[model samples]
Target: MRQVGGIIFIIILMAVMFLMDWYVYQAVKTLLPDNNLVVGKIIYWTFAAGIGLWIGFTFFTIMREGHISTRSQLSLNLFLTLFVTQLTVIIFLFGEDIFRTLNAVYQYLTSTDTGKAASLPSRRKFVSQIAISIAAIPFTGFVYGIFKGKYDFRTIRKTVYFKDLPEAFDGFTITQISDIHAGSFTDYDAVKRGAGLAAAQGSDLFVFTGDLVNHKADEIDPMMDSFAQIKAPYGQFSILGNHDYGDYTSWPSREAKQKNFQSLKEKHKKLGYELLLDESRLIEKDGQTIRLLGVENWGVGFHAKGDLEKSLRDVGQNEFKILLSHDPSHWDEQVKKHPKNIHLTLSGHTHGMQFGIETPVIRWSPAQYRYPNWAGLAEEAGKFLYVNRGFGFHAFSGRVGIWPEITVIELRKA
Candidate 1:
């Protein structure tokens, strides 16, 4: 009887998801009048059926096995089903466009003149099509998801030798880990592994650039021990990301959200991190002082409320400074052109959610085009920005070419 009720509940949930998909498809189709309605209908039916079967099978498998099943067969099936469906929909929607783009690429390659090549459509279309096809596959999304959920680790280790050193802190190593979205979906073991990885990187200082939890601070309370493991001789410091403010979900009032933010700040302190909210701290090394400044989420056209100037007001203009900001846009708009030079800015709001190929020269995330300095080390006008891909997964629950990043930056004197 219990099994029957459970199955019924699963069916209802599946029906809801299918209806949602159908509604979305209809809404989208209305925008493309020239689109093949037959193909759209076929795609919609395929998606609905695929989602239904996937959800149904998942529930059945769960019923057959105990709550803590080791096989993970059902999960795999569900993942594959979603992946295949996504692939099918992508192909259905963009198959002709991809073919056309490929033909254009072939023509460009076969052509002789530089002008002809210049006139040729940039490889963006073909590359985007291929990337979409790859991501559409269940194997790709599922495998990446498994690794991201399990490992809780990714790193960028680049040897950047600086010609000049700052008198205060030459050869300073900073370890930055960001976007640890601890919540209902993230496994405890993964969090533990992530903290372990962060601790293993021997650095003078540790910084968590933000997005501690997906929703509420309470969601992260159980995982405090995991986070506590991240420590350094100097200290572990943090700043708030947009999500840390709890704006996505409903809070009874503005006061409630403020309370939640305060709780998250306290939680960070409890985990042995100095929560820097529009504030600055000085690190003393070798009898010289370097300033560390952190700001609230301030992005152009998004949340441009963070006071970068105010945060750096107390710090000396000539002091070597590192800024912990959540949004990369902040670096582009404010820090890059600020009268007082900021040496290095670390951020990780762009989880590289759509992690895949952008072009021959670039592995792209949707975040890249939106922000000037989207990922990796981007330098403009003598300022350096390193955008960590992120420490954890969100929304789609996967990582592809843009894997979860753990950045170990060796700050050199110039």
Candidate 2:
């Protein structure tokens, strides 16, 4: 039954791709010179056929190996780039078609003969030329994203003030990173550089919100040394994210899955991160202490294994508390409205959809549609949430304007 379903899905996908190719090709032909039409068609169809073959190979590889190779992932990104470009071209061409149809309808209403009314205007070469020209923007962006933008790590520093913050801990800094989907990484040097940047922050504490690996525990083994470079004066703490549980992939048995989960936890230990599972830790300075709580993966639409109540065990009502939860949805769904006051919540998992525009004056991402606090900081009722953009790319295999983020937050007593 599953195989049949898979076959059906692939058939539908190929049909859609073919339709897009045909429509885009029509516009493309308009731009081609009459003398070189044959050459242009050969080049365009060959490129499209290569993409189709790559997709088929990827699907077969996944079925056989139960995992996607880095090469296949990169190919997938290429496919997405071309797909987006085709959509842009199609949008312009579709508009032209609509205009032509509307003009034909208007002509029909005033025509002397019904036969003449059936004729529609030919597509304008100018429109096709403009469409292809505009499509280059996204094509260039995707190429840049694949080659350079994925490794374009940036350090974002923020300051959060709270009246209830422990006075002794004022000016305390924490460096946070999240969603290191190490399996998707092809460049170890860039990964190490990002980790080195985080360590250079020299923060009082360091924390990883979640997602150390994409599917398996072994995925992170290669990048272990890079992440180990990140340390803090206080300590480094971590919690699980949805991907950390290895739930997305299939295992031979339940025990195998459990073993992988255990191995992932040990990876954290080897990296010197205290793996906090529904637990709290006390950080003391100058004879005053604040609480740091971490919970397992919990989100509105994903795994909800995190225990906020258990993590808050023994936490004081008035103590300055910081919570580490992987998904920002936790803040909206539970953390903010909880009876106990969690002064600040740190989260990731959105990755700002790995594409967006962010600037001093404006910020926008498709991720915002799904998550209100998709990236950066949001405060309500004096409680704060900061969503780290993420440390690695995932399915898209690249980052655009959002970039990969290492966040440094300074806590102040107001």
Most accurate candidate by TM-score: 2
For each candidate in the order shown, give its overall lDDT on alpha carbons: 0.72, 0.91
RMSD in angstroms, all models? Answer: 11.8, 1.9
Candidate 2, position 159, lDDT:
95
Instruction: Give the worst 10-residue stretch by lDDT in candidate 1.
Output: 65-74
Shift in Å, residue 297, candidate 1: 1.0
Clashing pairs in model 2?
none
Hey, what RMSD does candidate 2 come out at? 1.9
Evaluated at residue 280, the lDDT of candidate 2 is: 98
Candidate 2 CA-lDDT value? 0.91
Candidate 2, residues 1-414: lDDT per residue as tens digits? 766676677677777888899899999898889999999999998988888777866766666566666777877788788888999999999999999999988888888886663678999999999999999998888889888999999999999999878788889999999999999987899999999999999999999999999999999888899999988989999999999998878899999999999999999999999999999999999999999999999999999999999999889898889999999999999999998999999999999999878888989998989998999999999999999999997878988788999999999988
Write the residue-wise lDDT of candidate 1 on 1-414 in tens digits. Answer: 987888788788677666546534533454433658778777778867875776667667766552313234445445544645455555544554566678888888887866775233433334444444564574555565555533546767744444434665666788898888776344677677777887889888999998898768887887889879888888889998877878656667899989998898899989999988788998987787888999988877655557887888778878877899999988877788998988789998887753555456967566767776677888887778888888875554556566677889987665
TM-score of each: 0.70, 0.94
